[model samples]
Target: MLVGLRAMLCIVSIVAALPAHAGTLAFPSTGSMPVLSFSATVSAGRDTAPGTALSQAFGNAGLAVSGTDCTITQDISVNGTLVPGYTNVYQTGVPGIGVRFYITAGWNGGWTDASSSQFNKTDGGTAHYTRADLVVTGPVGGGTTSNLPSMFIKFTGSCIETVTATQTLTGSTSVTGNGCSLTTPTLAFTLPRAFSKNLPSIGATTGDTTLSLGLNCPAGVKVGITVTDAVNPANRSSSLSLAPGSSAAGVGVQIVNGATLVSFGPDSAVAGTVNQWIAGTSAGGAMQVPLTARYVRTSSKLVPGSVNGKATFTMSYQ
Candidate 1:
């Protein structure tokens, strides 16, 4: 009887040294993930209010946990530069705009602002085990912005499962209006005739002509310009197609601004348009954008009679 009693005591001690099973909390695979996205052409100029909403989206971002009862928590990290004077608003990649981010979390029972670079949400409990709608705001009129801010939120908790998860969201926007008034709305380029034998081969350019675009703008206005091919508005290539009625067959026109080949886009003053290039900011006076025009051989067989191409310009201001 004494030996049996000693053996039972040893078994109980070994069982006590084993580790206990823990719970976990994480973002669901298909549902409750944050969704913040926007794309629109807002009016050009400053917003009347600092936090004017350009767009917003609602999404249910909840966590999945193990066990019937559990405790969930979140740690916040901001990956953007916060705008001055505002806690939760950050600078959009766009120059003149700001973005606001927050969530009405189930565990907190109120709106939680994601303002600081590092923070904690230990108040989470069973109230957030299932669903929570996240709110993402895209505000405009602060400056010219090219891209909306991205979101990354992480969650951890004490549930039957022991795991950590994160949620991510992305966004975008466009701005439109009359940029600076064009003083030189029309520009004409005339190229001299080139001998086919003199041209070495296709892709060689000749007759470079220098030109300038003039504009009048208000003081402190940021300016951007876009050039579009008049013959084909959708042409995004550096070479311009010859306008109809041109007798020349194997040559095309090309324009350059400050060593960069100018690609064509649709005629629009919207900010962030393709090939939009920034001219210097205005100081309440006239500005001149210098450019160069040249003719390039587009085909191996040269048929030179008369080559003409037209292009249009659109300006945007912040």
Candidate 2:
């Protein structure tokens, strides 16, 4: 009877130990298992207003100003299933993932103003002006970060700004002495009061007046321009006062484009000739005209460079 009781106790103890051993085998006992995944998105943010005279002028000119904005978002996921031999692990074994987001912004602006005025038959005037600006903003060295794995991460970055300005002028004048009888008038050119005479100057009394033009480009951009006269000098004349019965007649100033004459008129005229030629009355007039040039980019490179060219004007008296 005692032996049987001992055997029964041993069997029960063995059965209890078997269950414990099976539980240990089903659970992971080695290293921790980690699984991670992450995703992010970047976008532009709102632009700030640029404060300057140039900005104000552009606004007055009906130009709408704009700037780029920046934004960033991130998501992270983690799972505790990366290890082998793990089956009955606890549901809360894995840790939550963390992430962060950041952003940056910058801006620039510029402009040019031009004007021309004719004073008399012997003098004229022209002027040009330009300006620019740039700006940047943000935390200089640090950015924001988020810790929540499921939420988007955001951070503000450093910003940059810049600006610039410029001015220019060109003027000319001409006079005819022989009234309407003469076919050409003496020409005079002047430089801006601030410009040095070391630059090229016009010395011809009767000929075409050529105006040199130049431009400064924006960063990463370049420009080039070509200008040609649209009128012929011989076919055009400037009108002037003339006495009745006088033979004086001709165009005053002429602008030519290729072989075609685009603009021409008389500046003065006389009624008669000298020494057996009937002396006629005299009339005088003057004009101020504005001209334009076209620019085109010849290369695809983004490096900036200046573009320069010239336009010609002819004055004729007959």
Off by over 4 Å in 1: 1-178
* Alpha-carbon lDDT of model 1: 0.61
Per candidate, the number of residue pairs that clash is 17, 56
Error of 1 at 294 (Å): 1.0
Worst-scoring 10-residue span by lDDT in model 2: 52-61
Candidate 2 residue runs with Cα over 4 Å from true position: 1-283, 298-303
lDDT of each candidate versus the true structure? 0.61, 0.20
Residue-wise lDDT of candidate 1 within 1-318, one digit each (tens)?
455443343444444564343544555553255555554455533312244455555555555444424444455555667666666676665544566666555453555654222223322333332112121233233334544444555554443343333334453455532246788888887777678865668888888888899998767667777899988888999899998889988888999897888888878655567888777777877988998999888888888688878888877675
Candidate 2: Cα lDDT at 70: 21
Model 2 TM-score, all chains together: 0.14
Report the C-alpha lDDT of model 2 over 1-318, residue by residue, as the tens digit: 455443343444444343211111000212111122222221111111111111111111111112312221111122223212222111111121111111111112222111211111111121111211111121011122122121111112111111111111111111111212122222223212221122122211122344322222212211111122223322232211222342322212223333333333222111111111111122233222222222222223322222222223322121
